[model samples]
Target: MAKNILIVCTSWDKLGDTKEPTGCWAEEVIAPYYIWKKHGYNVTIASVKGGEVPMDEASLNPPYLTKEVEDFLLDDEAMKGLMDSVPLSDVKGDDYDAVFLPGGHGTCWDFPDNAELIALLSHFVDYNKVISAVCHGPMGLVNVKGTDGQPLVAGKKVTCFSDAEEVAVAKENVVPFMLETRLKELGALYECGPEKWAPFALRDCNLVTGQNPASSARVADLVVDALTWK
Candidate 1:
């Protein structure tokens, strides 16, 4: 059977207190979604709440907007999937071989403390299956506890949207907290690329992570490699 992949997205749409709209970065989800489909994997999109995941408006413009995202905007099937995503509460983690969390500023508001998200990640941990995230997606990993009752990221080699990148984007003060600092606080052996906004991805055992929107395809490729060779 083709491997089943569950993609969890953020439901929150606002950028902190600002009126600026934001959710999953279009490239983050669009790039990886097509990659998984190309590999013949079954992909299901879900969110903290069911239905209508918002794409960060800025991601639709230059720099962040890529061919994959442009294609996604024109694909009715993909649009329907995003518009009618399943609620995380309705998903059973066992049904998937891997779980991927794609990110944007919206994740800062909703991912960290979600009970359903934590429980689903726990299932992936218990089964020793792949758990992957990119950019702000790693925020979902921060609060997850391992079998030893420690933060799941503790001692694991991982990377996410760096603190420097946040400052570069001028959202350092706007986001809830610094992801790099939080990961380190949780004892993650966090790593990043040589510079900000680069394609950086790391696979430490079954835990895979990418640093930014630019690293989405790299993260998906790593997950595919892991699944193929396991």
Candidate 2:
């Protein structure tokens, strides 16, 4: 049977108090979505509040947009899925084999400190299900605790959008917190690729993480491998 996978995107569109527009990174979600679909997994899109999930406009511009992202934009069926995402509160861990979070600065505002999301992540961890995140998506994992009551990311090898990458993009001060710093503070043995914006992904057991949008497809491939091997 094909496994069901949940792809959670950020619902928030405003970038902090700056009122700037931002949402899920297009490639981060599109790359993984296509990869999982190509591998015969049933993928579902969801967001914190459900309904239309915005894409970070910056990610759609030249230099950031990719063929996969452009393809996603032109695919009506895929766009429909994103536009009609289910609410995160309606998502049940038991219904899916894996859950993925794709990042945007918007995620920094909504993914972290979400009690329900944290509990859902804990449930996935307890069941040994795959939990993957890329870029700012790892913010979702920050507050999740394991069965032993420790932060789920504590002592785990992981990676996300790095501080240097944020600085390079000039969003270091705009985002709510530096993702690399927050993950490290949570006790994650966080690692990154040799250079900023490089495609890098790491998997520790059932947990998979990617460093940036460039790493999204790699992260999804790793998730598929882990699910198949398990």
Candidate 3:
């Protein structure tokens, strides 16, 4: 049977605070898409909202941009998927085997406060389905609560965009709370990469996480594995 996945990406940015326009990393979303699509998985693109996805122009240019992203942009099918993404309110865990959230500061603003996102994640976690996130995408987990009324991430090992990386880009001073600190407060035992852009990931049962943009593809791969596990 073909595996199915729900891919979530960020579409929010706040100008100077971002230093650069930031959206879901193309590599993180594209690489994973290629791998899973090749292996015959049905992938769905969704956002906090259900309209046009705002891409980070900076991440789509130069060394960061690759053949895959260019192809994805040119692929009308995929482009349509991005442009008319489903709203989180419509995504149900039973409809997909896995759920993946690619990262960006945009997610920090959008993912955390979305009630629909919280419900979707709670459904995935409750059913033992794979739920994964990369970089700031893990911010989506902030409000997800299990049926027990406990935070779904509580006591789980996870990773996301590090405070160190945010500081290097000069947003640490202004951003309210740090991701690492917030996760800690939720009782999540967070782990991260040794350096800013390094790839780091965690798999605590059904919860999967990645440290930063570099960890995106790997994070998706692990999620696929977790979902396809027998």
Candidate 4:
């Protein structure tokens, strides 16, 4: 039987400072989706608002876009599902083997504060399954509390969209709170490379995370490894 994996996509387009036309880095969602499918894992997507998921139009073109994305675009039914994804509340914690979050600026808005997301991830962590995310998706880690009532990320080493990357994507003056700084405040031991957009991933027991869109597939691979290793 295929192990079930849930990938969280962003429903919001604009972030705190970014504009609407700028949305999720399509690669973040597509890369992992492609990898997991090839690896024979059952993947489902849930969005914060549960409506149409916005795609970064810019990434839909050229070498920035991979062949897998082109195939997904051609599959009308699959594209429709991606456009109109299920809401988080409709997803049950026990239905999945692990949950993965792909990131973009939109995650800065819809992901960090969703109560349902907090509940889903909290439950996944509680059950000791793999709870993984990349880029801004790690913000989902912000609100989850362990049964002990401590921050789920407390004392865990993690990585997410780095401050430098956000600054590079949207000028330093525009982006909101630095992810590194905020995770640090929650007692998460944050570490990363000297440059932004580097492939950085961490696994704290079953919790896996990657630094940015570039690390999406790697994070998914790690998630699969964790599940099989179990």
Candidate 5:
């Protein structure tokens, strides 16, 4: 049977108190979606509130926008699927082989404290199912606890959008909390690429994580490989 994959994205469209627009990073979700599709996985899109999920306008501009993102924009079917993502409340971990979270600054505002999302992640962990996230997506895992009542990331090798990268983007102060710091505080053995914006990902048992938007495709590949190997 084809493995079913759930892709969760942030529904928040605002960037902190700056009132600037932000949503799911286009490349972060698009690159991985196509990669998994190419590997013959069934992909489904979901979000906190669902319906008309927004793409960060910044990620759609030059330098950040890549062929994969551009292709997703031009693909009507894919575009529709993204715009019509299901509500997170309607999703179940048992129905999917894996769940992936794609990030944007918006995720920092919503992903961290969502009780339902935390429960879903815990479900995947309990079952030893693959759980993956990139950039600020890992914010969702910060509050997830394992069956033993410990932070799921406690002592687990993981990575996410780093403090230096956030500082470079001038949003270090804008986001609700520093993702890198919070992950470390949660006892994640955090790691990052040598330089900011470089592609880096880590896999620890059933959990896979990427450091930034540049690592999205590689993270998806890692998830597919892990599922296949199992």
Candidate 6:
């Protein structure tokens, strides 16, 4: 049977109080969505809210745009799926083989404190299922508890949008908190590649994470490998 992968995205569309538009990073979700499809896995897109999930404007143009992202935007089926993402409340973690979260600055606003998201991730951890995220996406994992009643990321090797990268993008003060620092505060053994904006992914057991938009594909590939081992 083909594995079912649940992809969670952010519904928050505005930057913190600035009213500037920000949502799911196009490449973050597009890259992984295609990778999963290439491996013949079923993908379900979901968000904090049930309706259309927004994309960060920054991710749709110039330096952030990639061939894969461009193709995804033009594909009717893919666009339809994203536009009609199922609400997180409507989906159960047990229905999927694994779960992946794609990051954007928007995630920093919604993913960290969402009870449904935390519960969904908890189910995966409790069941020993693969859970993966990239960049700010790991914000979704911040509140997830392990079987031991501790943060799922605690004592686990993990990586996410780093503080330096946040500064590089000049979002250090705009985001709610520094993701790498927050992960570290949660007892995660966090680390990232030496160079900024380079593709970097890490897997500690069933938990997989990537460092930035560029790392999404590797994170997706690692998720596939994790599922295979199970």
Provide the TM-score for each candidate, comma-separated. 0.98, 0.97, 0.92, 0.91, 0.98, 0.98
lDDT of 3 by residue, 24-112 (tens): 66777787888888888999998877777777776789977888899998999988877898877777779888889887667777788
Q: lDDT value for candidate 4?
A: 0.81
In candidate 2, stretches whose alpha carbon ends up further than 4 angstroms from where it belongs are: none
Q: Name the weakest run of 10 consecutive residues (lDDT summed) in model 4.
A: 14-23
User: Per-residue lDDT of 1-230 in model 1, one digit per residue for the tens?
Assistant: 89999999999999987898889888888888999999999999999998999888889999777988889989999888799999998999879999999999999999999989999999999999999999999999988988899999999999999999999989999999999999999999999999899899999989999999999999999999989987
Error of 2 at 67 (Å): 1.2
Task: Identify the runs in model 3 with alpha carbons over 4 angstroms from their true place.
Answer: 13-21
The per-prediction tally of clashing pairs is: 0, 0, 0, 0, 0, 0
Q: What is the RMSD, in Å, between candidate 3 and the native fold over all Cα? A: 2.1
Q: Per-residue lDDT tens digits of candidate 5, residues 26-117?
A: 98888989988888889999999989888899899998989888888899989987889999999988899999999998898889889989
Model 3, residue 208: C-alpha shift (Å): 0.6
Model 3: residue 95 alpha-carbon error in angstroms: 0.8
lDDT of 1 at 163: 95
lDDT of 4 by residue, 78-160 (tens): 67658788888799989999998887766777777788898889888789889998887887788788768988888998998
lDDT of 2 by residue, 1-230 (tens): 99999998899899897778889899999999999999899999999999999888989999898998899989999998888999999999999999999999899999999987888888899899999999999999988987788888898999999999999989988888899999899899999999888899999989999999999999999999889988
Residue 60 lDDT in model 4? Answer: 89
Alpha-carbon lDDT, every model: 0.94, 0.92, 0.81, 0.81, 0.91, 0.93
Write down the TM-score for model 4.
0.91
Candidate 5 RMSD to the real structure: 0.9
Q: What residue pairs clash in candidate 1, if any at all?
A: none
lDDT of 6 by residue, 1-230 (tens): 99999999999999977778999999999998999999999999999997899999889999888999889989999998789999999999879999999999899889988988988888898889999999999999888889998988999999999999999999988888899998999999999999999999999989999999999999999998999999
